[model samples]
Target: MSAYDVARHFADSWGLVFLFGVFLFAVGRALRPSARDEYEHARTVVLRDEEPGK
Candidate 1:
């Protein structure tokens, strides 16, 4: 096979897997119990009257 065809096949398979892996990692991190408090803080930080510099 030509170099371009080889590259395309590799990307079509490995690139998709890599992207899916990244997506799963992000979803897993976001849903973990340990992250709940941090997410809660971010969700409410705007409601508080804290300085923007902080």
Candidate 2:
């Protein structure tokens, strides 16, 4: 087999597994309880008031 064939096989198999693992980790982190405050702050940061003049 050639380099192209080897690369294609890895991409078609292990690449998918790596991407799925990353997706699961991201989803888990987002849903975890400790992240609730961070998410809430992000959701309302735009509505918060700030002092004028630097």
Candidate 3:
């Protein structure tokens, strides 16, 4: 009926499932073997791109 009601419904029902699905997906993506190099590159690329100061 209202924004609060809609938000409450999502939070009580589908929101938990959606968050868990996202968590599982993130874990699966991180643990998948092919993602290793990509994540590693992600970790280092930021350092490589940064300069001496912020």
Per-candidate count of clashing residue pairs (backbone under 3 Å): 0, 0, 0
Give the number of the best model, judged by TM-score: 2
| TM-scores of all predicted structures | 0.78, 0.84, 0.60
Whole-model lDDT per candidate:
0.96, 0.96, 0.91
Error of 3 at 30 (Å): 0.2
In model 2, what are the clashing residue pairs, if there are any? none
What does candidate 3 score on TM?
0.60
Per-residue CA lDDT of model 1 for 3-44, tens digit only, reads 999999999989999999999999999999999999999999
Cα displacement (Å) at residue 49, model 1: 1.0
* Candidate 2, 1-54: lDDT as tens digits: 999999999999899999999999999999999999999999998897887663
By summed lDDT, the worst window of 10 consecutive residues in model 2 runs over 45-54
In order of lDDT, best first, we have: 1, 2, 3
For candidate 3, give the lDDT. 0.91
Segments in model 1 whose C-alpha atoms lie over 4 Å from true places: none
> What pairs collide in candidate 3?
none
